[model samples]
Target: MIQVKQLTKRFGQTVAVKNVSFSVEKGQILGFLGPNGAGKTTTMRILTCYIPADEGSASIAGLDVFENSLEVREKIGYLPENAPLYPDMGVIDYLNFIAEMREITGLERKKRLREMIDICGLEKALSKQIGQLSKGYRQRVGLAQTLIHHPDVLILDEPTTGLDPNQIMEIRQLIKEVGKEKTVILCSHILPEVEVTCQRVIIINEGEIVASGTPEELTNKALGGQTIFIKIKGPKGEIDSKLNNLPGLVSFRKSSEEGHNFYRYEIKGDGHREHCEDLFRMAVDNNWILSELRMEGASLEDVFRQLTAKEK
Candidate 1:
């Protein structure tokens, strides 16, 4: 539902985004990830038509964002990092104002307002002034205004930034539910949240597209191969010799030596199950006590660091 091609943007001599390109299919939730000053917000602004790119093109549902700015705005709901809100207005009144601005009136507006209140869990705060609400509730109000128009695409930047753990989970679940029907572009610094909430990911660094794929795919790319952690009780020399001769053993290192001949080892290899089996067989044959044998795969955070870390 969204497409960007060779998108580049600059402010003075600084390049905010360079040759960035990616696409989101209809009903897909894409996670846009980057560290601070990585042009995440700038790219979102351009996609939402809040700003124009200096070079390349972007389109929403085939409508050029630059040429058809107004039309593109109609199809997108944008909740910026800091939600634009009026402190003095009551939650319901603010939603009503947004509805009016969106040309939603009468029965249609009423229905949408009711739906947003329920969907955003804003029933108790409707009568309260926005400024009086907690950060979580205030965020809900922002989301309500964004959804008031039922836009096809939702561009949310740090939707759960300041909320407690419970509030973060609630917002994540809400976004997951909304994503079933609408295409979503979610920008978050929280890697775990993105891994759970988004179907695919795009990582940008230094204003360039660094990586793009499913969370698992990116994790595998970062890890290169599987890692196995094992804790065994045996003679150090014998254990080392067995591990060194194991098939598919890429690398092995003794992590620590505990009391009573127990040792912890980290082993890296190509075939995951094959290596585990070899370790098990060796432990049994050598009468070694195997306490822990587990596979450790790369997490989204690992992938993020691997792709975005500064060059040495």
Candidate 2:
């Protein structure tokens, strides 16, 4: 429901986004990730029509964002990092004002207001001024206003910022429910949140997209191998020699030394073979007691750091 083609933007001599292109299908939630000064917000601003791109085009639900700015606005709901709110307005009044601005009136307006209040859990705060609400409630109010018009697409920038763990989970679940029927582009610094909530992820760096894939795909792509952790009770010197000689093992290091001659080791393999069976046989031949063995892949955070970190 959203599309961009080689979108580029500049501020003076600095290029904020360059040749960036991607799409979000209906009912899909996309995680847009990047480090600070990486042009993530700039691209979001262009997509939401807050700013124009210097090159290329963006469209929402088949309408050009630049040519049909008004219609495009009608099709997408944007909740910026700092929600645009009037601190003095009560929650109900604020939502009503936004509904009116969206041209929703009469019976439709009432229905939408009720829906937003219910969906955003804003009933208790309806009578309170926005400034009086807690940070979590303020975010809820921001969400209520954003969804007051029931737009087809949702663009959220740091929606969970400043929220406590409980509040963050609440908003995360809410976004998942909304993504059941709406296209969503979520921008968050929280890697775990994005890993669990988004269907796909796009990582941008230095004004360009460096990676795009499912979490599993990106993790595997980044590591190009499997990480194995094992604990064994044996002579440390013999274990090290055997590990070094294991075929297809990329590298191995002693992670820790447990009491009673047990040691923990981390091993890396070339992703082409399994080492557990070989290690088990070797341990049996040498009468070494094995305690722990497990393999893990790289995490989203690992992939993000490798792709976006400066100095190559």
Q: Residue-wise lDDT of candidate 1 within 234-307, one digit each (tens)?
A: 99999999888888888999999998999999998774446788889999999999999998778899989988
Model 2 deviation from the true structure expressed as Cα RMSD, one decimal place: 2.8
Taken over the whole model, the C-alpha lDDT of each candidate is 0.92, 0.91
Q: Model 1 segments beyond 4 Å from truth?
A: 223-225, 233-242, 245-248, 258-262, 270-278, 281-288
Off by over 4 Å in 2: 233-248, 254-263, 270-288
Worst 10 residues of 1 by lDDT: 269-278
Candidate 2 per-residue lDDT over residues 174-267, each given as its tens digit? 9999999999999999999999999999999989999998987788667756798899999999999999899988899999998999999999
